[model samples]
Target: MAETITIEPITRIEGHGKITIILDDDGQVSDARFHVTQFRGFEKLCEGRPYYEMPAITERICGICPVSHALASGKACDAILGVHPPEAASLLRRLLNCGEFIQSHALSFFYLSSPDLFLGMDADPAKRNITGIIEAYPEMARDGIRLRKIGQQIIEMISGKRIHASWVVPGGVNAPLDAGHRQTMLQMIPEALEIIIRTLALFKKTLDQHREEIRTFANFPTYFMGMVDEEGNLEHVSGRLRIIDAKGHIVADAIDPADYREYIAEAVEPWSYLKFPYYKPLGFPAGIYRVGPAARLNVCNGCGTALADQEWAEFREIERGPLMSSFFNHYARLIEILFCIETMQGLLAEPAILAARVRAVAQPNFPEGVGCVEAPRGTLIHHYRVDEDGLMTWANLIVATGHNTMAMSRGVLQVAKRFITGAKITEGALNRVEALIRAFDPCLSCSTHALGQAPFTIRFMKTDGTILGET
Candidate 1:
């Protein structure tokens, strides 16, 4: 008889999810699905709240990317109030984003995925974790911890708190970058730059050994989307949207993020709470595309910083067109950290960053607003509709992980088919499947924000694979 294999509470990811693989009577894999098992309706929850409170309220979506949420929410609130933050505020916001990228990416690549890369994928489950990494590669593990700390330190220095900071507000941040904090942040950059350089070298050295993994881990063609500056350099804050085809051709360029509905649409699946977003013109699954580190590199013309630009060129050389495999996200993340460090150093060196006029006082001047930013994971968008009194009537958030849902689901099937040939499966094969999802570094808690009642069901089953009851 055919059977179903389920990997519940998929490990090494930010939130809860599971993978179900279906087998044919001959024990051949037939289908697979990735199910995001938890849901927190931040959009719905924000209804009726004051629009100005959005920066703090919506940021509760995920602890890992709270800075991203706060920034996006702040931008939308900026629009609602019809005011622009001072130049110093803009610079500080971007600087904060750099810190967020470093910390979040370090956590993804080191604490979560590094074990599989260092310790074998088939290593005992208990040992295939951060503790094992610490035991085996003490120096490298310390580097990861230190790098993440520097990032959080930058945040604390700028906003008074690292996570869920209320400093980011409607018109601008609550305070300006002081001279003391500026010097401290600048001092930290050198160490950050050093760590990233060595880590990049170490990772490159090991690439040859993971050839089989590189070949199978979500290595498929799909459109890519990300934010880019006017010169088409990789941008994390305040830029227009760019979508490139798998062949590295620009299908859409300089799209006003406010017009996202014109180019993007969301669809629902019965088995998962996460909504699948795709390029609108192509429609549904056919419009499937990817976002985040790999996609960001694929869409940008260059990194705009010296060291990262050189690495970016070398990375692109992997394919004449855009790199398709999500596995490269790991490599792309390291490059981004290099870019962030360099970018932060430049921003802190600017004298105007210490200006005290950081905020613009304003009342609600618009009833609708939208904001966009490149979160550590990918592009994050926040849209809001408000009453004349400034109370939120409705809101929607398109998180980075949500944008990649289709590709991830399809990737699970591809990996499952490649490794599961019979009823019996190896532990390594199962891990490779989970590792495929890890490549995207999904924050499931931030993605599953359905507006209304989402499709859900409960089923009780026997140990022998028989369904006993349903709800």
Candidate 2:
């Protein structure tokens, strides 16, 4: 008889999800699925709200990346008002994003993924957590904690709160960067850079031990996407979109984010609430592509910083072409943290960072608008249609994790087939399946916004396990 194995509430991730593995009669793995089980209708929730309220409203979607949501929403609102924020405001916004990337990446790498790296994957479940890491590797653990604190402190200094700060607004931020805050942030940069540099060196030493994992965990060809500056360097806060194929060839360059629909489209699956977005030219499942740290590294020409540029050059040597394994996302994330810290240091030293003018106030001048940014996880896009009175009529958000749905689903199957050879699977084998998803570091809460009507069914069962009916 065929059997199904389910791992509920996939551990160590930001939101709720599960994995299901089906086995053949011979006990061989047949298929697998990664299911996102929660749904928050953020798009529909903002329909009747005023367009200016979007930045505040959408930031509520996820506490982990509220700054990302706010920035994307603010940019869309900027377009609706038909005004541009001052150059100083743009610089400040980029600085805020730097804080977000450092903290978020720290959480993903140190607290969540490091346990498996430091401890063996087959280690006791009771001991495979941050507590275990503290007991065994205290110094690394301390570095992780300090890195996240530094990131949050940077956010609070600029926006007055660590999470979901309202400092970001439609045309610009609510206040300019204070001189005291600038000096304080600049003082913290050296320590931030030191921690990431040391951590990256430590991480590189462990790569050889996980070679099997590196090869089996979603190691396949696909397209990559991210935002890039004019010279095609890595960009997060603002830039044109760039996409490259698995062979490191640029299939599209300098795409206007406002016209995202021209090159991208969304599809839905009945099993999961998350929508699958793909390159429109290829259509549906055939258009599968990836985003986030590895994708960003693969898509961009360079990091545009001293240390990071050196690291990026060495990172590319992992393969003849773009790194294909999702496992490399962990390595890519460390390099990005290094990039963010170095970038912040330069931005803070600028004389014009403290300019008094930070905002531009205006009413709605356009009926439709779009905003896009490279969120810590991947590319984030917010689109809006407003009425003459400045009230929102429709809104669509394509979150970072949503863009990787198809690849994640395929990855689940790949990892399952490689590890599970019989009906009685080992705990470590199960952990490998979950570990694959962690490599993507998905934020299910932010990605589960459904478009149109999502598929839903309810079933009643008898005590004997017979289903009554499902609708």
Candidate 3:
């Protein structure tokens, strides 16, 4: 009979999940599954709310990435009003989003994922935490905190709060940037740039140590997707959809955001609330693709900024074509930080960014709207239908992490097959399985819209229903 081993609540992650390793009668690993065990139904919850309130209401999705939700929601509301925000307001929104990417990526790298990268997967669980990083690599730890704070400071300067400011609105931002605020933010950028440059250099050298991981951690070929400027430059706030294959060929380019339904589709499985999004042309599982940092870099021809462009060139040189390993998300993330800082600085230097007229007032002019933005994790889409009175009738949110669900599942299986052998599983081997999922830096809380505390239970049992162990 086949036996089952379950790892409940994969540790050092944002939300609850379990990894099930199924062994055949002969005791070798046969298959593995990653289960998302919670659901909040944010989409269903938003029905009947006023369209203008979406920026505030949907911002409650997750504290870690509420700004992403707010911006996307605000953009959708803008569509309903049939108005484009003034140039100043648009620039301010982009600056806010850049801060979000910097902070969120920093958290993933320093607090959650760094422990494994620095302390080793097999290190004592007690010694594998931020405190551990602090004690062992004090300077690196301090730099992480300082860098994250810089990102947060920019958000606070512009929006008056760190997490959910509710400053974004249907047509534009609530306020304009003043000269003092702009200069203050610019002063902080130079130091942030230094940190990103230093960190990327160190991380690239660190990659040489994990030889086996570089090759097998979610490394298979697949399609990549994200937003890009008209010139095929990396863009976040506004751009057309672009999809590239693993072989470095552009499969689709300059795809209009409204036409996304023609290219992307979602699938639901009994084991998870998060839907699996795939390339519509290739169909379900076969059309599997990746998003976020690695996917963004793969789809764009350049980073658009000078420093980041140089880094992008070097990143592509690692494998000759589109980088396939999810492991490289860490590197791509740092390069983005550099790009964000540079881009934000340039926007602040423009005197027009502090213009007094930041908003454009208008009533709802459209019955439906779709908003898309490149969030820190991946591309986020917010689609809403409204009544004539401007009240929301329906909403569908395709979050960044949700888009990578299928890729994460495939990754779990590949990693399990590579590591798990025989019946006896070591803690080290199990942790490595968890580490592969972390490489995607999935925010399951945002992915599933889950609420409340779910129980974390692991069980070891046989196919005959006999319980052998439980945690």
Whole-model lDDT per candidate? 0.88, 0.87, 0.83
Q: What TM-score does model 1 achieve against the real structure? A: 0.95
Per-residue CA lDDT of model 1 for 228-325, tens digit only, reads 99999999999999999888999999999989999999876666443668899987557878999999999999999999999999999988999988
Per-residue alpha-carbon lDDT of model 3 for 1-471, expressed as tens digits?
A: 888889988877777778888888887867776777777878878888899999988888878888888888888988899999999899899999989888988988888878888888778888888999999889889888888898888898998899889999889998887678888998898899889888898888889877677777888788899999989999998898999887889999999776778899986544333356778987765677889998999999999899999999999889978998898998898999989999998888777788888899999999999998898889988999999999889988888887887677667767777778765677777888899888898887777763222332222333232445433
What range of 10 consecutive residues in model 1 has the weakest lDDT sum?
Answer: 456-465
Between candidates 2 and 3, the lDDT winner: 2
**What is the C-alpha lDDT profile of model 2 across 331-440, one tens digit per residue?**
99999999999999889888778999999989999999999999888999999999999999999999998788767766777788899988569999999899999999
Q: Which of the two candidates, 1 or 3, achieves a greater lDDT against the reference?
A: 1
Residue 224 of model 3: what lDDT?
A: 94
The alpha-carbon deviation from the true structure for residue 65 of candidate 3, after best TM-score superposition, in angstroms, is 1.3
- Candidate 2 clashing pairs, residues 3+ apart or interchain: none
lDDT of 3: 0.83
lDDT of 2: 0.87
